[model samples]
Target: MNRTKILYSAAAFIAFSFLAGVTLQHATAEFVPEWVKNTAKWYGEGKTSEVEFVNAIKYLIENNIIVLELDQKKTESKTSPTFENIIIPNGNSKVGNVGFYIPLNLEIEKGTTVVWINDDNIEHTVQSQDEKGNLISLFNSDLLRTGERFAHKFNDDGAYHYFCTIHPWRVGVVTVS
Candidate 1:
């Protein structure tokens, strides 16, 4: 090839490599909370839970809200960790009980596992499905034994609607992005 053509081709290659590196660096610049970092690593290692797993996203975000308040702590980065929680209480109006009618709003990324704990002295099952009341996966234990727990992992990317089959009065929704 001619000397000028060769030099032009080499310059083009160098420019492409530089641009690729810049793009990759920008992608990883997103900030992921340490809790989520640990959770992802642990989940990848096959750990499971029915309570804290889903709440990790919420925990990290809530704590970060305080950190980001400081000018030095905030970053121009845009990546965020998603977490949430929902507690289902037993039916039969025991009145004055906490977690009853308490709706938890959460935003979680895809592949997060949500754990549901039955703190009531009754049995409850965590079932997921569409809005039409279809059957999804059923995770439950006998009366939850008043401190029993149930957990499920969500790998898909979308919203998952869930409810308690045993108690039709119980209903909840989870959105996985």
Candidate 2:
């Protein structure tokens, strides 16, 4: 091609490469922002609860420090009401209850199915129970290993409490309305 065309092509290639590099960096960088590192450090030091650490991440998302983009059309097409899934993290030896669920309390509409994902290496069970510690018998998950998930659908309106059988201290509540 002509000298002018060659220069234009080279410039376009450089610009595209720069843009691609920036996008890759932003995409591959740890999802956690710098602001969350301090809270995570505190959690590691046993100064913060799992709920509080998750709330810190939520705060970052709310403030736009972390942006989450979802396909609205695809998500809305689902028959059942889709809710944000909860995560059960692994316990840290230094922190007593770091293995607890991220959200201690969750509120959802009736008929919504809540999924609890086991992100921890240890096994966990999600057993629904009454306030007096009696099993509800409606939903009891099997021993969940790492990367396993348990889902429960709440058809009626009430508050349901659940705990991990192995770790009684790891408790969570779900309110259906």
Best by lDDT: 2
Alpha carbon lDDT of each predicted model = 0.51, 0.68
lDDT tens digits, residue span 1-177, model 1? 445434433343334335433221121113545465455344444564524444553453355521222332345454454334555555423434344523544456775667666766677766666668787554433444456666666677776666666665555666777
**Per-residue lDDT value at 46 in model 1:** 50
Would you give me the overall lDDT of model 1? Answer: 0.51
Candidate 2 segments whose C-alpha is farther than 4 A from its true place: 1-80, 92-95
Choose the strongest candidate by TM-score. 2
What does the lDDT read for residue 20 in candidate 2? 34
Q: Tell me the TM-score of each prediction against the true structure.
A: 0.43, 0.52
- Worst 10-residue lDDT window for candidate 2 reads 20-29
